[model samples]
Target: MIENLWLIGIGTGSPLHVTGEGMQALRDAAVILVPTKGAGKDDLAALRHAIVTASGTYAKVIAFEYPVRDPSLPYIERVTAWHDEIALRWQHALKDAIVGGPVALLVWGDPSLYDSTMRIAERLDPLPKIRIVPGITAIQALTAAHAIPLNTLGGPVQITTGRQLRAQGWPSRAETVVVMLDSECSFRTLDPEGLLIWWGAFLGMEEQVLFHGPLAEAADQIEAIRQTARAEHGWIMDTYLLRRT
Candidate 1:
């Protein structure tokens, strides 16, 4: 029986973003599962490996291949099946890696925000006790790196995804909306009038990039830079906050 299953948030990209609590969690686990999305995107896997090595944890580190989500299937359906496969992979890796762990899986950003590690873990049979060590989220990093406050003077803030923004224009409720998991620059679809945007790619890493201005003026530039970065690095993780002026 497993004692603890820790989903440690190691922040967006920077190893420095690993929290002390998360580091301790790594040290405690017997097996550390680091996942790779195959080729062209091994940087993430490397970063996860670096965290484990830097933590001085002699615990067995297991590197597993992540299941690629089929874009043809409906988004909901694809994600459901993908999670199931991922859970199965974790089960096999944990079983082979060792017995009775306190296993740790380093999650990107905070598991609470737009992450599915916990959801996938729930699918495992004979579930183990769970512990979460939250790290900095992309939005927090974005605001911090750019030196901007998340909310404007007691104003409401809503966190959402690019799909929602594209599906239903700007949200009618919140003065500020932070969008994540957006490969598409959905802000271009909205009326950029009176809207200010702060965008960042690679959040806290060395290749980090930041851009901000009126959405109308900066949207194109952002798209171009994002495309170039993705082409260069083979993958890019980004988030942005749009504030109504």
Candidate 2:
């Protein structure tokens, strides 16, 4: 029988975003593993703590410090190694856990969307049967936070990363593009003319900040706020949407 491993999406930065299904999974799991990205991201681990408290789960909770990639190496190679290391940590931790019963990992956002907990989990030896509990995604949170629809009437949407947008420029055949995991604010590299932007940081959290205006007019302001927020908190996760008028 394949061992049970559950990836529970706790939503991004919001305990309220945790679905009743996800909470029930947490309450039922034999073990819950929370990733610790070190100090600046302690709040992320805290978010999981909040979920546990809210769910009223008494499951064994373990905090593991995730492996950090060497920035000097190529992205693919470095991330590949990082994932391997993380899997090793999980293997060691789970091996001796509460009878190796159903294991739960509290992931940010939906596990299928950009978040990589599932990829690392795939590397575990004697892989566990993977089950996912979906939660709100950053794009969804951003759009709702801004009171805007994801796309214009009948318009296609392109979702991409900052690196791809920076390298390939704007994508064709899409009226709206949503960018995530971009620490650099790559939107400034595009021609801001005829474009509108809605940017948000710490979405669904108390410290959330938002800006919306003509791209050319608000790009700088958004970057400035992003920098200030990052410096203030020592970390930041943000997303933005771009639409051509």
**Candidate 1: global Cα-lDDT?**
0.90
Q: Report lDDT (CA) for all predictions.
A: 0.90, 0.89
Mind giving the per-residue lDDT tens digits that candidate 1 earns over 123-172?
Answer: 88888789989999998899999999999999999999999989988888
Instruction: Report the number of backbone clashes for model 2.
Output: 0
What are the runs in model 1 whose C-alpha is more than 4 Å off? Answer: 1-3
lDDT of 2 by residue, 69-187 (tens): 88998999988998899988887766556545788899888899998888888887688789999999999999999999999999999999999999999999889999998988999
Model 1 TM-score is 0.97
